[model samples]
Target: MLRLESVYLRLKNGSEEVPILENINLDLEDNKFYALTGPNGGGKTSLAKVIMGIYKNDEGRIYLDGKDITDFSITERAKAGISYAFQNPPRFKGLKIKDLLKISADENSLRAILRSVGLCPQDYLDRECDSGLSGGEMKRIELASVLARPSRLVIYDEPEAGVDLWSFENLLQLIRNYHKRGNVTSVVITHHERVLSLADEIILLVDGKIADRGSRDKILPLIQEDARCCWKANCGGNNDEVECY
Candidate 1:
């Protein structure tokens, strides 16, 4: 349902321009789950931002449902049924959860949205979204706000970041359920093995370009091999020595 045509992006680091995404052309089908994963600085998040219109592409165009949206504003993209959940959810010191949901989505679906995130409406509806809440709570709150209105496509930038194990599992279930819905597309920017397993296709971005994209069998082994060398404490075959990052 989404397409990118010769997409290119570069950013200025002081005086030099560094390429973030180079000639990215992708076609994401409707109702499919695609995971974007790769090494640090591989431009996964940059590509997502370009799709969401958070960053303008240096060249080329982005189209959603056959319409060119390369120039759409972030708000305009949201209005057109696209949602992007940030890696670090923002805090609103004085905003209550109920008020945040009401402003972000259809007012009638507040309770349903909370429940969709596995939160009890009665317990969290009155709670403030401030430092008092835990990181997991904040993440879920942000997700709920983005999902307040029904979206044709949702891009989650590293949903597992900053969440505890318990919250991470819950987030996975939430995403799984969302993907089960018909005719909606999901793109997740993540490095977690569990998240990678959930994707219909795994896309490995390397050095600002797509290195490979295929089924789990074709891609997982490659990444696992790289992870074993880089992530393992002593680069040993022992399972206990592996430190997941």
Candidate 2:
């Protein structure tokens, strides 16, 4: 299980302090998928980064399986069964796809890893991680690496960002397969409704806070309504308070 208690991150904007995340509390049960959705600049990415230990929380604690990981470094968090995939994956100049997958899995061969992400071993295994690969190809390769890594909690930041429609569906099915095979906890950060529907639970973040948290059926309508009203529903004017998104 994963638990975040009153987690907060503060940063400087000009001279004033801005809250990237407010007093947030979340509990994620084991062997489930949670999808986080929100508008741009709503702090969804920041929260994901904080959970991965890329950014330290100014206040609050993070616990995985009841152990405090707030003081842990990024490597420590990875060692503790947390894996994160970035929205914009970095390019490795001379590394072949097979080499990257092998390193990610800490093993000899990565044929299964490549296959899991719908890549053909004979075709892509030797390709370099460079500009020669298209954007969708890079996204799939990064996803293959994420699947290769054996981690209890896997966080995918915009897995559907650059991929084509066919590949996107393939990726989604692969994630479902992963859930069935390993029963590993997964967190997906996406803006699309189709991606949101794939989650076991949907968390809507607004203004650096969890505005709504529930099953997809319960939250999707609210999100649509929120979008229609320009994020102001029932309430009269623009209020800073973050309600169910």
Candidate 3:
């Protein structure tokens, strides 16, 4: 289980302090799937970063399965069974795909991990995880690396980004399978309705705070209603100015 108590975060904009997350309190249960969704720039990703230890909270405590990890570094958090997949996965200039997988897990299991993400080890194992790889390829490789590790909490920031339709569908199924195994707690930050529908619970964040949270059956209809309003004619004053809910 993961718990956040009265968490707050602020950012420095020039000389002024701007609040990014405000009074966040949450308890994420083990072996559950959560979808965190809201409009862009709503601090959804910032909250994930704080949980992953990429960013520190200015106030309050974070506990993972009874241990206080509020002051833990990113490396410490990873060792504590927290894994995060970035929105834009970094490209390693000198690292081979197989080498990264090997570092993530044993060499004997590398091929299976690659194949799980729809990559052929014989073709990609020798290639460097550099600019030569497509965005979707890099994303899959990053996800595969995460899968190689044993994690109690897995957070994926926009996993569907930069992938083709077919790849996106496959990725969704992969995630579903992983979640069904009940080995880790999953948090997916996504705006897609398909992804949102898969969650056991949906958290709606707005203006740096949780606006609402409930089971998918309870929250999805509200989101769908909002989307429907935005798609109607003259919803945004004119068709040329259509707004996404």
Candidate 4:
């Protein structure tokens, strides 16, 4: 389990301090799937970074399983059972896919983990993580690497980013199946409806604060309402990108 108390994070903007996260008090139970969704610039990724220790709070404490980890560095947090997958994962030109899985998996399990992410071990296990791979491929490989490694809390900042429509479904199923196994907590920062609908709870962040959080039935409608409002104000008669989140 993880808990954040009175968390406040602000970044410097010229001579002034701009608030990134304000009074973010949150509690996430173990073995549950949480979807963090909201409009752009609402501080969703910032909050996740704060939890992952990439960003330190101006005031507050971060606790994982009752231990205060506010002062923990990002590397310490990862060693403490927290894994974060970036929105745009970096390409390690010489690192093969299996090299990542070797952190905690054996040869046999490495194949299984690749298969779980819809990649053929024989085809991709030896392939380098370079510019040749598509965005979706790199995302899946990054996701699988994190999942294969033992971690109590996994924070994925926009797993759907740069993914094609076909790959998005697979990514959703990957998260769903992993959550079903229990024992590990999954927090996915996404704006996609299908991803939000799969969560045990939907957390809405607005203006750097917790606006609302509840079941899909309760929160999905509110998000849809925001889409409609966004359509009226910003869509410019084009229904393609709603800018809802």
- Most lDDT-accurate candidate: 3
User: lDDT for each of the candidates?
Assistant: 0.87, 0.86, 0.90, 0.88
Candidate 1: deviation at residue 75, Å? 1.5
Candidate scoring better on TM-score of 1 and 3: 3
Point out where model 2 deviates above 4 Å. 12-17, 106-108, 231-245
What are the candidates' C-alpha RMSDs? Answer: 5.3, 4.1, 3.7, 4.4
Instruction: Tell me the lDDT of model 3 at 94.
Output: 96
TM-score of 4: 0.86
- Per-residue lDDT tens digits of candidate 1, residues 95-131? 9999989987776788899998878999999999899
| Residue range 153-178, candidate 3, lDDT tens digits | 99999999988888899888887787
Q: Assess candidate 3 and give its TM-score to the true structure.
A: 0.90
Distance (Å) between predicted and true CA of 187, model 4? 1.2
Native-referenced Cα lDDT, model 3 = 0.90
Candidate 1 local Cα displacement, residue 164, angstroms:
2.5
Best-first order by TM-score: 3, 2, 4, 1
Q: Which regions of candidate 1 fall more than 4 Å away from where they truly are? A: 230-245
